[model samples]
Target chain A: MEGCTIIEFILLVIAYFIGLILLGIYAHKRTKKTAQDYFLANRTFGPVILFFTLAATNFSAFTFLGFAGKAYDSGFGQYGIMAFGTAIMAVMFYVIGRKVWKLGKEKGYITPPELIGDRFNSTSLRLLFMGVMVVFTIPYLATQAIGAGMLIESVTGASIGWQIGAIFTMFVIMIYVIFGGMRGSGWTDVIQGVLMISALTLAVVFIAINLGGFEAANTMAYNASPELFTRPGGGDFFMPMMWFSFMLLWIFADPMFPQIFSRFYTAKDEKSLKQSMILYPIVVSFLFLCPVLIGIWAHGVGLDVSGQKDMVLPMMVANYAPGFVYAFVMVGALAALMSTADSQLLSLSTMLSHDLPFKKRKISEINIGRMLIVILSLFAILFVITSYNPREGIMGTLVKTTFSGLAVLCPTTIAALYWKRATKYGCIASILIGETSVFIFQYNILPTFGLLSAIWAIIIAIIVLIVVSYLTKAK
Target chain B: GLWWRQSEPLMFGLPFWVVYLLILTLITSVAFYLFSKYYW
Candidate 1:
């Protein structure tokens, strides 16, 4: 916002990049031998690092940036819906995570789709899900990269080219993820997790001090716009949208997110998996509250900068915070964005290379994974450039809607894991319906409903799976 | 009509704030031992 602030931000950006480059080099040398070392961190990470890894997979830039914007503009209801989807998923981790962990250990599984395909006897199902995941996630990835660049701008100044910043940071993420693998990602997540909290805590503290405290923040916000705190559906419709989006897209629909699944086979026992599950949702709940609170603070302060929404947190830090504190905020935002991006690039790459049918032995998987990393990187960069204006982009909208559509897979996936009777046809039917729903919704051909898309999709999927499984006798 | 702070606490006591720090310390110590014995 000022000349001196811009100078401080640029210096902070330099220091943060230097730190990450060194960390990448350090990880590359530390773990190099087996793919297990690369992908699963040798299955030896303690509950702590493992805790953050599971949590990191959830705290994307969207949480830090987009949701903060949402919180700033709307109110707390959206945050509550996020909690609901997360709580249900956490229970899955406690109940289903252990099962997946056990099965992974027994079978030497690498991805969620591997388990899904094996259990249900459906190869096409695995590939189809993986394809949707990669395509849908690229926009999600672009969101991360763009958010990171925006963070750079918020701290340093708008003079820094977003495309330039995004590409450079993305390349750094690829190097660490490609070379060091999950260990790199997991360790980085631990550091990034700390930075994310520190940045959030710093911002929250500064804002609260300025506004006096949470009570004062609430009072001031009410003074500005009573609707900010109390409105139907929590003053904004975004929360219900997220509940459907997160559950269907993340929980039930996309069964195999490679990062989380990669950890499943690596976790030592059922106890570790259960503990990690319980710990993760709670940690995420805490991390999410920081931004949401900051959003409330922003409303109270009455700062109405327009067009760029996600930049609220960083810009607020720049405005209210001292120069050195602003530096910390800059690095913290970097931690949040890259933590999510590194895993995304790695997982997307792995899905393409190892999961897709390459023309050779399964052991030949290593090389394909790296090559796919480069392609995914290129594809993501192109998509970001095309997006030009993220708010109007078809990609993000498609991803948001499609996630709800995937709700069709929820019942089928959960049933497949436990119910031995879950036939291949059941899984197939769910996938077909889910994919079709996403396409239909993306085109806006259907009317809006009260329930989330994922909920409706899952409801339909379960009914079909039950009826179809019943009609088709077991072999 | 409804109370809000109830959702944000731990064991309804002072421990909620310190829980993650404790877990982090415990997990790190155990991990260090496991890694040194097996992978390192």
Candidate 2:
């Protein structure tokens, strides 16, 4: 609504894009015309860079928009679930990342599907994983696009609709990622990570100063809605079993996400992976905290956040924040979204170009990877422009659906890595059972069996994997 | 029920749950550091 604020924000966004193009050119010079250079960045990332890229990729718009909005709508319990789940998931990385790194190095694996397919000696199963990666990743990618669009619309008003903003985001991401490859994405992630944190820190400081101090802000929020400071009432908030399921959701499925699992392949050494895992939860918890504080601030200011939950942060900043502060924060949100969307598209491109059955013998791997990135980026842009819905909060119903779908693949990965008895037939059975059960439970076609759909899916998958492995063992 | 799960006993002028989350995060970082040092 304010002229100066909108002008300053637009200028910052333009500056950010210019920065990304420069980074893309730098990455392009180093990028060789090979799969390893394009997809895994030649396995060159150390612990610190790995940590930043992973943290940036992991948080996404979901952290700032969806999760923060959830906190505003629900309560502080959203933070507890995410912070604790992430800690536990970090431990999973410790257990899994080292093994994956070693295997990737030894066998020259780039995607999770490639690793699993070779391990099980089954191409069909690998394709299944690739299918899951492409199908489920679209919404997550679209979420980022939708988030960027919403941020633009919130700041710029109806002059530029959110759909056009989303299209512009997709176009920008396609350029850097198609030219720069993984190195471009990884280096850009470092910048994006810093922007993401700075945005949150500035917003937090701005809100705190406006409300007198952090304590006063908390008091004001409590006065405005004491139940928002508590648990389990306002809107199906934090039921015990449901909370347990939400916690399990990320711990089990996040490591299987193509974008994250591929990072395990890029670690320079075992120690780098180990150290990153050790530091990950700490960094992410801090990142996660910033948005929750903003959410609480929104509530304290008495915004109608529940009705327009995703708009909480942007609306607050646009209405009340200092112009430059809002500019930096919006760019941070844009950087966060692009960082995530690029990573996911890169992973999807790797799967399509390298893992799929269709083989083109003549084309260079880098070209194919770049081509796939363009196609997938266009697909995502189309999805966002035609069907993008902001009503689906960042961490809300849609992400849960995606996570639940992805969780089915986790048992197959764990069993393939750890259990000698895990067979091709077993993995196939388990993946089908796990994925199908999520749909069944999610749509309430079957009883939930006293737990969430994801939990039920995991239970069913583990059982089916073991049973089929034993029964179908080689004679 | 866990004591920190309650809303009472606001620590440092914040809710018990919020303080509990910070403690949980600290414990997690420390535990992870130890794990990396010894086991990993």
Candidate with maximal TM-score = 2
What lDDT score is found at residue A160 in candidate 1? 73
Instruction: Please write out the lDDT profile of model 1 over residues A325-429, one tens digit for every residue.
Output: 767867787887888788888777766765677675655465677777777877778866775465542224534654554445456557767888878787777
Candidate 2: chain B TM-score against the reference chain B: 0.70
The 10-residue segment with the lowest total lDDT in model 2 chain A: A1-10
Could you tell me how far off, in angstroms, the CA of residue A110 lies in candidate 1 after the best superposition?
Answer: 0.7
DockQ of each: 0.05, 0.57
lDDT (Cα atoms) of all candidates against the true structure = 0.64, 0.82
Clashes found in each candidate (C-alpha, N, C closer than 3 A) = 1, 0
Compose the digit string of candidate 2's lDDT tens values, residues A162-223: 98888888888999988888899999999999989888888887878887888888888887
Candidate 1 similarity to native, TM-score:
0.84
Tens-digit per-residue lDDT, B1-40, candidate 2: 1242367766644678777777787688888889889887
Q: Model 1, B4-25: lDDT tens per residue?
A: 2122232211123224333443
